[model samples]
Target: MTCREASEYLQELMDTTLAPDLERRLRAHLDTCSACAGELTLQREIRRRVAAGVPRQEVPSALRQKVREILAPREKWAWGFLPRPVIRWGMAVAALVLISLIPLTLLQQNREERIASIVIEAVNDHRSFAMRVNLPTLPTADREQVRELVEAKVGFQIVPPMGQRGELRLVGGDVTYFLDRKVACILYGKGSKLVTLLVLRDEGIEATEQGFRQVNGLRVYTATYKGTGVVLWKQDNLLYSLVSELPQEELLGVAKEMAKI
Candidate 1:
């Protein structure tokens, strides 16, 4: 191949195996052209750095299915103008080019974005309740009354810490939508900082598992999503998620206290 032709196919040459004749000509040009060889070295180094710095993230199932659908062969394609082998080869090359361009960071971002959406939903719900014009919903500090109201809507009772007098007091109770299902929220505030204790039936919410800890005989799972601290535990077939911007220690303390109830 001439120097210009070799340069055009350099990336493809580096990426995959080429036809024997094409590979032979490219190597012949490289042997005579020092500049092209140096350019090839630089491209390899850049690719190496990109591969080393970014860890591979698994493709999401939905994206994998979509890719499969796109690559699936049709019954009688218009590309029949080309031989079957040629069509297959062209499709493979196109698929490889498309796949190579997808960065690992993109997959990681998809997962983080999903979790962030949940966090945003929680934050918005809290802000809406805090900024309400009036108490349009039930406002009660009574544990039994709040539990009955929340359980009636969510099928999960809000269990407060074992004492009537505690640092976190239940100011009110309300219902909110989380993952298309009703979530029972019990509002509590120590001072200016508000805490939303969300109780619901676990339906496999996607959360990165932090560390599991035993607190007050309950296996508590701790995780942070989008800078928001989250502590979840299960009891009586229901899941309790304590979400707030509070420090991890403070949040864990609240979760432990609730677990004691």
Candidate 2:
């Protein structure tokens, strides 16, 4: 699909309303086109922010009255002056959709926002390493010692997978706050590319198997949030979200290996 075609399907892709075949084609386009992928990521973030930050309230009577007045026999219909009963029926359906849709749309958006947020934040935090790479960090040559040092600072022991990541060398790590909860970010690198592993206490909302999949027989949640790949899994009281810009197969390969331990 060309960029133009992909753009048309993007909203449906976000809404999951596209046919499976079309969705696959658009996804293929996104995988190879960084510009479109970035566009999608931008749109998704905006949608999520609106869903999560907006306040919800019941429809006010004044607003209802205003709507009623507006819908009350506006002007000539394109089908040449519709009958009163026909107009009233149209108004009733429109009003039903408008008045009842608010809460339902809000509920759906709230759930989508919550689940989408499970990994988008990790994607963002990983992206931030570009700017923060120059910041001082504990040496990551020794994973065990690095983990301990991070625990000392963050007051939480993070168990990063002791599995082969091919050429990904541990760059460095730091402690930070996400949603007011203390967390650890361990950076790994191969050449100039990077991957981030975030460890934080489970806040309970992420338990749902929203983007769930099995990696090496272990259940892991995966998503393509913010134009990057993320894999999430929980062990004990802690949750692990691995974020990278790699293809899903490569990303999941590392994650499955990490899940082995």
Candidate 3:
């Protein structure tokens, strides 16, 4: 190998990709040329330092706040509402993945996008409702009256599955919407565990063989968003979802029990 050839092969040598004959020739040239050997050593050192995974310098808190203020309009639509930094990244990615992935053709044929949309919304509501029960002042209801309140206010009759599990109790239920679809937000809890069940008109929300599992002969769509478990299934003309921090299998059981209603 000439000096020029050795220079050209330096990257491949560092990458361990040179052929036997060419690599032997390059090594022979490098052994005789002090300048080429030094260059190869320098390249190896550079590669080693880059592959070391150096820590990044975080921006100062004050500078970050200033940048956020300057970018508030865009950031508000992005991450401003998500209170904790820990949940922010996961939520943003999940939310973005569903939106950016669905093409027009897939939107017509599949329910994956719809599942993700509901899961994200359900988890958001689950977190908020868990913090503070969003009890409506006008049409309030206790455990016994939650079903009646949901029927009257939400324009749908739902058997709130408070009786499905021993550790579950009815907390609240309210009328909400996603796009133009009226949604029934049924909140339940037992001890410290929280569960939010959303009932909406079915919009082709079916469980595909790949992303869903059959539970008690029902196609159940179970997903984990952030650390929360989301179980979505359709019964009759309405779609149902149970969102909580409970184990997904438990959620599936609860969903299956709710489907029986």
Q: Give TM per candidate.
A: 0.47, 0.52, 0.55
How do the residues 113-220 of candidate 1 rate in per-residue lDDT, one tens digit apiece? 544555567666766666665342668777677778777887655655432347776788878887557888888876566677777665554443334567666677
| Best candidate according to lDDT | 2
lDDT of each: 0.72, 0.77, 0.76
Candidate 1: minimum summed lDDT over ten consecutive residues — where? 203-212
What clash pairs does model 2 have?
none
lDDT by residue (214-254, candidate 3, tens digit) is 77888778888989999877777788888989887777777
lDDT accuracy of residue 179 in candidate 2: 51
Ten contiguous residues with the weakest lDDT in model 2: 72-81
| Residue pairs whose backbone atoms clash in candidate 3 | none
- Pick out the ten consecutive residues of candidate 3 with the lowest summed lDDT: 135-144
Q: Who wins the TM-score comparison?
A: 3
TM-score of 1: 0.47
